[model samples]
Target: MTIEQSPAPSDVADVYDGIGQIYGSAWGPNYHYGYWDDADDTSSIEVATDRLTDMMISGLDVRPGQRVLDVGCGIGHPALRLVRTGDVDVVGISVSHVQVAQANELAAAAGLAEKAKFQFTDAMDMPFPDGSFDAAWAFESMWHMPDRGQVLSEIARVLRPGGHLAIVDVIERGPVSPEGRKVLDHVCENYAVKSLGTVDEYRTALAANGFVDVEIRDISDNCNRTLAVMADAVETKYDELAALVGEEQATSLLAFMRLSAVTPEQGYLYLAAVRA
Candidate 1:
């Protein structure tokens, strides 16, 4: 396979727009849920994502009447889930127009038309006022962001004082060898991820941006297992995905899945974090 270079915003946008189209259909609804146990069974997408969403929500401690923002909300699944609490107003933002449209449709269907909505916008340039939200969450999407610090800064800017931010994503870890880096770079290049930082890197950024009470949780096992199961699922639906997104994209996605299985199996990593 030919390896590509680091992705631009437009490049990432195209990849995710396609992902948004087949996200629920191919991934089975957990929308790339993180893993706690590499061996945990992910046969059931509903169960896997449910556990993942619960874990994420628990960290945010979202309450009724709170204003929440979901940065990089894919199809607004988590935002929809958050509205079930009956006390939160949620706005999901995505760079992909397709995802925003789909998410809005899903939100409307779930009867959360007023409380939860998705818009097509960049996280680094969100069109919201300062102190606009009580909490912000980024589930498995920050890694895909090219400028995470800027995104974090924007998040900090929009959050109310002492507002919470919860993120569940893959983080790079110690002593990455040349080979390991190559594997990671290959996956990132093919899939259009600009960069993925370590857990400490994130803490430093959060602190630099004036965030406190930062917590990083090791969920590599969960990520690994999810990737493994998802690989199988993708393979099972390879034909359909190719039909929807073409062969090159489908192959690239499989390469992404195969790489995730390798990273955590070889090193320790944090898959999630919550900060105030």
Candidate 2:
């Protein structure tokens, strides 16, 4: 299966706009992968997803009264958490019009309309002034970027000098076997992902974009349980998702989840960097 060489904003928007709610229902507020502390940690999906957000918050290390750019923000729950955590203002952007409206409503309902705002914007070409933000984050969204470097350059451009950036994402750790390639292909095809980058590529991309003091953490083991948990969640909500997104997408989601759940090729990592 061939996904676009570079994931277009429209393609990404169509996919999320159609099935954003299904993800919320199955994966809770955040659309990114959850983090499990250990094999013994039996936290619920909500707790695990929140845990990942908290990790980003720590990595961001922004102070009160600062501004954060939430790149590819999905429905704004993570932005709400970040705003409430440090009393910082967050500007979240998403290509999906449906998600931006829903995200704004979520913020307003949470009494965070003043602190958190969501807009329909593409990360590849964000319309923001230079040095507009103190910190930024791209959560599970880079997978959809056709040119991750260009997106990183935009992020770096908008952020102030010394601004910190956090990215909670997945990567290709090493060469995958034929069996794993099938899983990766299905995931990229069905999920509207363009391609997976290796850890070294990530470093090179970040550094090239004027990011310094990079810290890339490999937390795949803790994050691997997400696909398994997601599989169960999707299975439980298959009928509802099928009704919303059609039978074909629902079936593909299940197959993607089933395959990714057992595949170890996808590595999860959260990286932090500071603008020089």
Candidate 3:
């Protein structure tokens, strides 16, 4: 199978630097999906996103003093929450300097600077040493990677034996209709996403890299709400978004929100595995 490379780092950084501001204003701090317990649950998007983060944290089985790595950490919200909830220190890495700066500022402002630190680093070539982390996670950030296997290899290398890894990402579920593919490609264009990974790809990659006890499951039902919510937010702030990312790119994003809202082929998946 041929996995594609990610967009250029500069391109990816530009994409996030603009969208991050929009996301911060619209969807609170977290840029990932929202979770709902069931049809009756009506938690706000901010709370739902945190719930998803907590869900990922729950699977890590981390200890208080262990270090955790946050791959493609957008703004360090999850890292900060992890330190508060589990008393673990986090070292978050992102390609975007804007994000690293903002995340560090947030961590400092929250008095968690020593516990959660963000840096501008590429996951494909992590600066961390072998066995540097006790646990790791990528929250909806894997798709931006140019080389999925390289990033996973780095994750595996940095994590100590018996350390747990968790990942939550959007994926191509299966057999996307041509029309759906068209929308998916358009979303990729504006979002700086090269390609989405499949569940089987993850399973194979994890096993090949000496990970064990891998478990992956679908969580789309809980996350699909994020698209519509984001669309609503973009619409309400279209002028502001246009100012940040220009009217053209901002319009494409809004259209993606509408199109991808009904695109069932785009699904969310969660995977947890232990490093061996």
Candidate 4:
């Protein structure tokens, strides 16, 4: 029988809706994306999460007892981590129902249920009143969004005056040579992703959306190191992970990892920017 077509990016949100459990089984608790350390250290989930969090707070300067929002928070790791600082109320929103449920479960289990909360909601259409938060963060999830501007605008709408938004995301670097563009296009098609924007494009969008103090930090080296580490780790765990996800998915993941390792080398970097 012919295989049914994979869903579009809009549908992708729904696809990941229940994938939080399988999400970590393939990689780890950090969702297995981006660089973990800026000092060229070995990359890992724990390191990446810490690095991203630091970038968020330092860049946005999150204040104690402030209300924060995490767009596309996978499994609520960052949100829970922020809560631990005893200075923020983090509201994590994701299109993935699975992630939200697991995040909530984790938070409640850790007795952080009151300080951190997870919602199954779209980033472009968040459910909150105006000036709902003092700060916001999006870690490596911006590329998954189709309308980055709309998402940013929504984020701005929810943020109070002088509020900050920090985003740690993957952005394309340099002009894609026509041939290289073809290769990238092939990868995007295979993954059913609609698009990936460049660093300049994201900065432009943030600016056009009325975000000030936009900055682009080149952390490609960090991502490259992390990708290499993950490549090695996943190779060793392939068999066990395959047993968990079956042969086809395991193979897909391997291909994905290999491609990602090469992609950053080609011209991709973890970009952290802020709005004030």
lDDT of each: 0.73, 0.88, 0.87, 0.68
What's the number of clashes in each of the models?
Answer: 6, 0, 2, 3
User: Model 4: per-residue lDDT, tens digit, 14-85?
Assistant: 545423344456556665355554564554567665765665667667777899988888888777777776
Q: Residue 265 of model 4: what lDDT?
A: 25
**lDDT of model 4 at position 208:** 85
lDDT of 3 at 77: 90
Off by over 4 Å in 3: 1-5, 245-248
Once model 3 is optimally superposed onto the true structure by TM-score, how far is the C-alpha of residue 227 displaced, in angstroms? 0.3
Name the 10 consecutive residues with the lowest summed lDDT in model 2: 1-10
Q: CA lDDT of 30 in candidate 4? A: 69
For candidate 2, write residues 57-141 as lDDT tens digits: 9999999999999999999989999998989999999989989999999999999999999998888898899999999999999
lDDT of 3 at 47: 87
Q: Roughly what TM-score does model 4 have, to 2 decimal places? A: 0.83
| Order by lDDT, highest first | 2, 3, 1, 4
For candidate 3, give the lDDT: 0.87
- Candidate 3 vs. truth: CA RMSD? 1.8
lDDT of 2: 0.88
Query: Please, what are the lDDT tens digits per residue for candidate 1 over residues 53-117?
Result: 77777777777899999988887887888788546999898877877888899888888889998
